[model samples]
Target: MRLATIHADEGTQAVGVDLSQDEPRFVRLRDEDLGSRPSMIDILSEPDGLHRAESAFNAGRAAGDFVEGRLAAPVPLPGKVLCIGLNYRDHAVETGAEIPSEPVCFVKFSSCVIGPGDPIVLPRVSSKVDFEAELVVVIGKRGKHISKESAFEHVAGYTIGHDVSARDWQKGRPGGQWTLGKNPDSFAPLGPYLVTPDEVGDPHALDVTLSLNGQTMQSGSTKEFIFGIDELIAHVSQLITLEPGDVIFTGTPPGVGDARTPPVYLQGGDHVEISIDDLGTLSNPVVAEPD
Candidate 1:
């Protein structure tokens, strides 16, 4: 089932689209046990909760009169948003980086998150803003010391993610880490909808492509990932506790602005669209920082 969280006047709420009826059906999940604040994150915490929500979504899609509209990201506020770098073989090659034995990880502040069609704000500090289209994994249940054998069981769903970066801040900075370069306002474009693990099947087999201002920039497949989801889970869990709604960016493919001959950084009013087979598409506009 495709689940999403739409931002309406009331607030962000869990919703599903009924393709058959062509309408929108909000999750009428009156969590009698948890009260009115039945947030997506809170619901995703329990393994059973995901199952129940999927069941509810299926039932609603069948029974309700569905309206056609855009779906937002399933998780509203993730506890932690961790990302992996250099996991894709072609991406690593294009960027002139070596393949790592272990997953290279990073963090993106939740504040960078924007809906699929939202505007991306290019920071004034860096003129070399680039885009990295990635597949984001949403955790189902909390787990620590998670084994690779059981890692897939802890996954809730998968969604398309655009890892917007400030190339200058990321490379030419004197910082100890890549935080400042990565975490700019409206840097991450997520959503369209979250497809359940069952629907997604093998995450590593999907086709991923990215376009900048309607020009095809990145075109690759998930098959080139150096470290798949299972390895990432086991490796990261060894150090920290993994919780529900914690998103993991499974790296990106080749063809970013920074990897070009002379480099082709994002200019004002650029549009980026990331498409992943089965999961759906994530599109957004890039706007320059206000003068």
Candidate 2:
């Protein structure tokens, strides 16, 4: 099931998008109507929640009205967002960095997340902003010390994400935490919608890419991931309790602006779209901060 959260007449509501409709139909769901409570974290904690929600949603759909806009991020606010660095082999090579022995994790504060078609703010403190088109794994349940073998069972769904970075801040500050580089407001634009794990045949095979002002920057497949999905879940869960709505950014492939012959970074009017098959595309405009 492709699920989403969107702005409805009733306010921000969770929805089940019936892909069966020619254009997806948004079926409204109240927090109490969810299979589990509306905790984005717990709903994904088990695959069963998705199954139950589907059953409940179908019956409820008959009485509600349907809207025709695209899907928004499944979880508008996660308590936390865990991001992986150098998880893609080529991405490491492009940066001239060494591959890590284990998944190198960092984070973006929850305030960073935005829905597709949102605006990416360019702060005046940093002149070099770049885009990293990546596949984002949205957690289903709470887990710690979970084995990778059981990890997939814990995932609720998948979606596209843009790990928009501030290159100047990342490499510039001496030991300044990467969160500063990564955690700018709305730096992470997630979802057009969350396509449940069952619908995406194999998370490892989907092709992902980013286009900036009509030109492609990052283009690679999830297959290129050094640690893959299960490994990422198992690795991170060991250190922290991952809750529902928590997202794992699986790193981007080569071809970022930083690696260009002469760096071509985002400006006030540049628009970007990151897309992965089935998951949906995330597009945002780059805007200069007002003086």
Candidate 3:
């Protein structure tokens, strides 16, 4: 099942589960649960909520329960937006970086997250904004020191993510820390929908691609991940406690703009669309910061 968060009446939001026949269709969770507004985070954090919701969804949605609001980042207020760097073989190879024995991790502030169709603002301080299309993993259960053997058991599902970057701050900064370069406002655009694990078999088997202005830029597969999801979860859990609604951006494929012959940074009006098989497409338009 595909889940989404969409605008509702009077500055509110509602959880929507897709019950499409051909085109997209979403039934409001509140309409199913007696008007209680459940955020995507709320649904994920609950132990039995998703399953119960799925059962109710299968049972049926009333014709009046359908919604027509704009979608937001599925987990709009995720606890953390953790990301892995150099975890894709082709991506690492493109930058001439060595493959790591363990996952190289970083954090993108949750404040940087925006929903589908939102504008990706190129910061006024930087001219080298680049895009990294990544597959985001949404955690379903809380765990510490999670084992690789049971990591997937704690996964709620998968979604599409973009690790937008300011190349100058990322590489040429005073110190080489990645947070600042990656934490700019509107830097992380996620969603369209959150698909359950069962619906997305063998996460590593999916094809991932990114296109800039209708031209395919990055094309690869999760099979190329140097450190797979299981390893990433196990490794990160050893340090920080993983919780439901927390997300991990499992690196990007090769063909990033920064790796081009003459680096191709995003300019105002450029459109980026990243897609992963099973997961829906996430598209965002680039715009300069307001003067």
Candidate 4:
């Protein structure tokens, strides 16, 4: 099943795919009528909530109302967003860093999130902005100290994500923490759609690619991940409680602009498009922050 959130009259409306036709059509989920799942977060937390909502949605004849161009981040206000760094072998190699035995985690503040087609603000404060395309894992249930064996059970689905970074702020800071480099508003552009685990099949084998200004820059697969999904989930869950709507950006592959000989960076009016197998392409235009 594919799910999405779209801007609507009252606010954002939760939507799901209706597979009854030749092409899957998106239908709105009337939360008021359904009486339980009010938001995407609520639906994700409940067991069998998707099934119940699907049945109710189909019976009400409310399918096919979705406007693909007006999508919001699938989980607009997720409780938190955990990001992994250097989790890919080639990515680690390009950065000239030793591969870590455990996942090197970071946080991309929720404020940085924007939806597909949204503009990624190129802050005037930093001139070295770079892009990293990654696969995001959206959590479905609450768990603490989750075992690696059962980690996949806690995943709601998958989505495409961009880890926009400011290299100067990230590496040149006094303390050298990445938070400042990664926390700019609209830095994390997610969605196009959130696809169900069943539809995505094996997360480990998808083709992940990213392009800037009509040129392919990063092209790789999840098969090169140094720390697999299960291990990363279990490792993070041990430190903090995983709740519904919590997103984790698994990591990005090689070909980051920072590693380029001339070090290319995002400028105003640049276009970035990222895609994963099954998960739709997420495209965003870059704009310089207003003076």
Q: What is the C-alpha RMSD of each candidate to the true structure, in Å?
A: 2.2, 2.2, 1.6, 2.1
Instruction: List runs of model 3 lying over 4 Å from the truth.
Output: 31-35, 59-64
What would the per-residue lDDT of candidate 3 be over residues 49-75, giving only the tens digit for each residue? Answer: 787667655544754567667878988
Residue 19 displacement in candidate 4 (angstroms): 6.7
Q: List the global CA lDDT of all models.
A: 0.81, 0.82, 0.87, 0.87
**Candidate 1 global CA lDDT score:** 0.81
Q: Per-prediction TM-score, please?
A: 0.92, 0.92, 0.96, 0.94
Model 3: colliding residue pairs: none
Clashing pairs in 4: none
How much is the lDDT of residue 103 in candidate 1? 95
For lDDT, candidate 2 versus 3, the one ahead is 3
* Residue 277 shift from truth in candidate 1, angstroms: 0.8
| CA shift of 23, model 3, Å | 2.2
Q: Of the pair 2 and 4, which is ahead by TM-score?
A: 4
Q: TM-score of predicted model 2?
A: 0.92
Tens digits of per-residue lDDT, candidate 1, 177-229, equal 38988999888788888778877857989999999878898999889999989
In the predicted model 1, the residue pairs found to clash are: 22-66, 23-66, 23-67, 24-67
* lDDT (tens digit, per residue) of candidate 4 on 1-291: 778877766567677766567965567676565553367887887688677666756754454444343788989888999999998898999989999988998999999999988999999899999999999999998998999999998998999999999998999779885889999999999997778898996899999999999999999999999988989899999889999999999999999999999999999999999989989799999999999
Question: Using TM-score as the measure, which candidate wins?
Answer: 3
Task: Specify the poorest-scoring 10-residue window by lDDT in model 4.
Answer: 60-69
